[model samples]
Target: MTNAEHISEIATLDNVVSPDKVRLLQLLQTQKAAFLAEPYPSYRSRIDDLKRLKAAILASKETLLSALEKDFHYRSHDESLLGDIFSSLSSIDYATKHLRQWMKPQKRHVGVVFQPAKAEVLYQPRGVVGIISPWNYPVFLTIGPLVAAIAAGNRAMIKVSEFTPHTNTVLRHLLGEVFSQDKVCVVHGETDVAQAFSSLPFDHLLFTGSTQVGRHVMKAASENLVSVTLELGGKSPVIIDNNISLDAAVSRFIYGKTMNAGQTCVAPDYIYCPKNRVDELVDAIKTRYLAMYPSIDGCNKRTRVINHRQYTRLQGYLEEASNLGANVIPLGDVASDETSCFMPLTLITGADQSMAVMREEIFGPILPIVAYDNIEQVIASINENSRPLGLYIQSHDKAFQNKVLRETHAGGVCINDAAFHVVVDDLPFGGIGESGMGSYHGVEGFRTFSHAKSLFKRGRICFSDMLFPPYGKKIHDLFYRFFIR
Candidate 1:
């Protein structure tokens, strides 16, 4: 179809839903029946599905970007291309390349007594998988997990966040062109609908969002004993070592924090820097931010906050910190107008545990800088809280980098950079304590949606029969004595 026709189709689909629990069940049942009909899809079939998804993404790239812009009012085009489009396409490509090896049955060792038998593990699909994606980076978060589910030879039902309604419409249209409803479907709804979607008896469920809502998802999933892979957000910390250059550290920090206006789940939540270098670090960040985004008043490249509610929440964080006697610093001279939901890159100094900004996940363009007297203090401070989804450390010194990495815990880490570790296809991306649980990326993702079923086959001559219990004979006694010792 033509581009205009596709756009018209998406606009028609935009008014399609009101978040009915009944529809969620119908979709689940449809996918479950389809999965049962072909429980173990061939490797070639799985590869074909993945290739189709990749093609769909490529074909709908411009439409997806436009929808994202409509949803956020003024989302950065480069951010959408790099973070969402590029990442999803990369994941599909990586999965397709390695799927043949992943689908192969792994040969295992047979014990001495069972020598006549052969053992191996078969990877089987886990039927219908449920995916709950958040609004921030909507396309990537939704499609990323769907790629894993498809790679594992399973059908999926995705529930996109209501906050990004326009993007959801585009996703519905894009996925509809690529997949049958029974094979892959996308649902759009509000909080109540999300709760209903979570409670479904899915073979596996994957959720990506805030820690607060993650708890609710887990609670609802428990009723069906559904396995979950939660990619939740927390206070991801960045440590600037005393030995590193302030300019180098701040440059990396600005890229991570300013991307999506700090709406990233793995975005640097706060900074732990030496007490003396706080001013220098802050100044460097300010200078770098302005160089990139000279004026946020009408800059198209600069992403705005998702909406007024989120914008107000971030503004409240700044106001609360200010009221509590913290030094609130704006990074640029640009003033944000209310119509655009624009929030400038800001710095909160003298921030302590008591301040809301420090206590909560700052999912906006607000950075809190906490001073540390020593390296030991930084380690102690990090350990005291829930492990974050990601940790960033900047230092040319190997010892300092190694020390920070070894002492602290996080789902992922980027040494000398920030938030880039997640895009690496080789690494398994996930969270530890509260940030999240379970991982999905590369081989880890393939295994997450598959069941490793152990298989044993007996030969013509079964050696195990010799040890079958009748009455203990002299040969059995000898065998037991030799093996037990």
Candidate 2:
């Protein structure tokens, strides 16, 4: 089918709701109750199933890449493969290898007031989970949570981004072939359908998108009081102390800033460097940018702005900053063809906190440089805004790095690195404060989609009879001594 046809199908909400939605909800509820009754899956069988899914994804690599490209006019095939397919496979492998340990019942200590009973924590699957993914990285955003949801033994309904019609269609087709719709379903639609999907009273809801939209999703989920995990975007900051190697710092910063054309949530939105190092860092970044994308004029490998709307928004930001007396430097010359797909990597200096580029999350190939003289000033700057989704600090001094990590609050921190922290399976990836709420990925992801039920198993002894309603002087004395004290 053509892109226009697929988009038309998604835009019309009346035809989007399949009978599968009701069937899947029922099946998921039944399965959840059964799993909770038993509370365990056959270890060997679970491992085998995960392995099968991993292999299936690997085999569909080429198809996934092609669909993603057709959806986004210029998404790099290599980027989709590496950032989405490879990451999803790695998450599944990590969960499979460590499922046994994560599933083990955790023993809890009983307080002195309670005797003849043992307490433990049982991680049981929430009946059904809803995943609302964004178009920027459709595969990873969908499969990343699915890896955790399945590992936790829960059914899921994934709502793919409407912006990526081709990718969404391809994913729905692929997933339908692999798993029964009742076990794993996919929903495709535009904004209205997506809003309805989020409003569904699922056991858990996971949303990845901008903060403004995340708020709407949360408000809708409030109708059912559904627990939600929001992975929203923010203006993540990068601080460079004078102690680091300028060359290494510049390379890492530029690579992360420009990757995926800077559509990443954790992309370094703005940088804070020592006042004296500002010029030096700017020069270094320019040198590294040229080296990376030598001919920015017609570079196909470098990603393009996703759509005209996004392109216009970015252009507005650039124009506004220039009007506000900020120096906007185009990293490389614009292509001769005005309609060229490329957007030159831009660096904006002299930007103040009041500027739109500084206030809003810049999900484009634009980088802003801010200068600070003291550590306290930098920390204050970060604290003044909504806590970012992620924070990056580059300093050779261990004390300074630790101070930044300890004093500042962010969803995640990557010391001496850019966004690499999210890939670690052992670490929880999510935001705090305005950036977002809840964490996921690896064991944390499993827990996010599951509820930790506390179970207390008591022996056949009725030791509590002494404290029954017929309170006597002796019972009151005992209670006072043990409970009050």
Candidate 3:
């Protein structure tokens, strides 16, 4: 699989798209109506749906891995299995095990004055949910949100990115095998279809993509008053503390930067290394990267850019940085055709705010290492920018790590590691500000796709009559004084 092969395949899919938006409308309507019919699914039914989804994913494992490779030219089989397939299965497993407790009504604390009344919150399904998945990890993004929606007992309609048509086909087939169109449906097309899908009146919408496009998705969703959970990307920064081992830091850094060829939303976009340790850190990173993949020329471990358009965008970033006097260092000396899109993992020095690589999210295998004298500068630099989806710190100093963690504001933070915070099902995953808003994963995910309805039950005998309106009695005066404070 190569860039040209992906383009030719996308051309074939382009012919299969509907001539208009009729199918998109039809699918949404069907899902919405089905949701209305089964407004609140039983815990058993939700688990069953999740089970079916898990089974479908396992059944289509090979197809999914192959499609991902075709879509990305050379996506690693291990990456697909761990990132896409395994994550999806784990979500289903977690949901199935905890849904019973999640669906149970939780009791709430009441004031002593309201002893005669009882209160609890009931988790209710939010009806239909719409998910717009990006091309980078098509299956994981789509299925991840779908898992949350299913756990909350809602029907879902997914819109996968156009660049990953092969993976989209497999997803549609696999999901369709488990769920009817009304229960869970996958929509496929280019920009128009995506816009139409986003504009649909879903109960909730979850979009995972770039910050710029996230604005459009949020705007479109707002038209219908649809609550959205945007899992967006930004220039997530990594800090190498002056006290940590360079080898350990660079090893973890290399994993985060090279995974999916740095196409991840939470991938370490840039690194802040000690001013004196820049060369040593860069050398360690290069050594670790090459030791893993000696040659990126035809390595399966090196995932290619999704398409030529993306490849060109990455190349343009490098070219612009080079023109702006950035020191570009390619990690591998792979003698290969540029058309293959196997972008060598490179490090950029002298990268500043003026350069495009530093300002925007570099969704490629390019890591811009900035030299910093102190941790305060790193904290200040992070705060000055829009909040990122993730922040990484390589430090063993408990006090320093705590200080950095307390000072910085990112959707998630990793200590002594990079980009692994998202895999922790116990923690909520999302972003803030330009990175995006709202969170979904674990309990937060269930709540994201659900409506926590507050319930109150009053006893037969109460003090309501004593506090009736039409009098200024001493008791009323006492009550007012007691409550007004």
Question: lDDT of all predictions, in order shown?
Answer: 0.88, 0.81, 0.86
lDDT, candidate 1, 175-215, per-residue tens: 99889999999987777788878977789999999888999
How far in Å is the alpha carbon of 341 misplaced in model 2? 4.0
> Which structure among the candidates has the greatest lDDT?
1
TM-score of each: 0.94, 0.90, 0.94
Which pairs clash (backbone N, Cα, C closer than 3 Å) in model 2? none
> Where is the poorest 10-residue window by lDDT in model 3?
2-11
What TM-score does prediction 2 earn?
A: 0.90
RMSD of each: 6.5, 5.8, 6.8
Candidate ranking under lDDT, highest first, comes to 1, 3, 2
lDDT of 3 at 325: 96
Model 1 alpha-carbon drift over 4 Å, by segment: 1-19, 296-298
Overlapping backbone residue pairs in candidate 2 total: 0
Error of 3 at 247 (Å): 0.4
Clashes of each: 0, 0, 0
How big is the positional error of residue 326 in model 3, measured in Å on the Cα after superposition? 1.3
* Predicted candidate 2 versus true structure: per-residue lDDT over 105-155, tens digit per residue: 899998766788899999988866889999888888888998898888777
